[model samples]
Target: YVAPNDSFSRGVKYRIDTDKMEIEQLWQYGKERGKEFYSPYICNVTYYNEGHYLTHSGGIAYDSEGNASTELGPFAKLEDPNTVLKSITVETVNDEVALELEVNSNFYRANKFTLYAKEEGMSDLELGQGQLLGTLGETNQMDTEIPAEETGEIVSDWHEAHLTEEVDMLTFQAKFEPGTLAMLVLEGEEETRQYFISTSKGLRGAMCTGTFLPEDDRDTRTVVTKDGLDGEYKVKLIVNDKKFETGLSIRA
Candidate 1:
């Protein structure tokens, strides 16, 4: 629909049923400089299943009421029509897991990142061993990666996830004892934690840390932790269930 600067133009709304797309055009009264006229243009375009799998366009602008689908900044200046995602890096330091993630959005949009983890012998992914430790905001060029472990008690800041997306960036420091052909389980009904395992001398055990998605099928696996010091080995996870087999040791 195109409205003339001097006259009114009747516009029509069209719906594409096969693609499940809807487009609307409406007429509005406005002044162009010193001239009075009616303007006809696409007022709104609503795509079906917008929240599920499809993406739509609305000129880049932030919504005051807070909506995720809305553009983060002035939509007209968006570099790409499709969404652009930032990059992330994960590493181990001082018996802790560190994460450096970047988000490239026009505006500060509420965001979440999820990392899944598993040990050598496990049947699923587990979040119990991976704790959320900290977060750093968006960065340019390179993101700042810091140690996930602290000298004090683990804080609650890094423990929440929206559905399958873990809300935090930092993962906790979880140490595992050494043993081969071991079946380690997390404290949840969802089978998590059956992933790759490695050891370092200073920590005196195996370490696994990263973000985890709570919903997924469990994959069985085996893990090896480091061996013997004279003390009882008790393992604790954020979720339910007791895991790990007895007698995990590394032979000299």
Candidate 2:
């Protein structure tokens, strides 16, 4: 057991030695010399089927009417992890920009990919076809070579029909700026799809895409670019569509 008020305490570890058991106190910084410590006090203890335990205290609350309540416990709930696009790099060469995306999910497979650019002031409901810069087929190679100025880690070992494959890379020529929104639509086998949009990276002329979404009732999501034109735009992954809708922004 660990004391809640003991800031120096790290945790507790138990060792079973035949018929004898030893309890060791773990500290963040080894052990203190001639220092006093508080005893472990029970607050709120929770147990899990996985043989794990969590203890928390002082999280309860009461209203004016004397009704007591407490926040959700640590093991109360769980959510599915979001699919991530990692190590995304955007580069500018000559007059064209290149995009490199690596899917971090081992279960989701992406085959077809498309990109669209929209103006800042456009209405959320009006997710026009924007500009269908281009699309990459089932292959992992791009038609045009990505110039050295815009090249990052290469995607290799892409096998057809394999769920866990290499990156999907594509390039296009377009002029975008701060407040401009860019959307990436990725299609996979059997209607498995994902969407992402550009967002501000809190830097001047240095934006990158992430998983940010706009608050609109429509199935479409949007994000505005931060201040940067370094070919990098922030984007947010919105939803995982299993129907593979044709429209740019529609209900999943």
Off by over 4 Å in 1: 1-81, 84-103, 107-170, 173-238, 244-252
lDDT of 1 by residue, 1-252 (tens): 222223322212344555656654332111221111111211122222212111112112222332222222323113323433222222223323343233332222223224444556554755576664553442121122211222233323222211111232212233333332222222223322332222222321211110111111121112223221122222222221223222221111
Q: Give the TM-score of candidate 2.
A: 0.16
Model 2, residue 149: what's the lDDT? 27
In model 2, which runs have C-alpha deviations exceeding 4 angstroms?
1-14, 28-252
Q: Estimate each model's TM-score.
A: 0.14, 0.16
Counting clashing residue pairs in each candidate, in order, gives 32, 17
lDDT by residue for model 2 (66-97), tens: 22212111111111122212221222232132
CA error at residue 140 for candidate 2, angstroms: 13
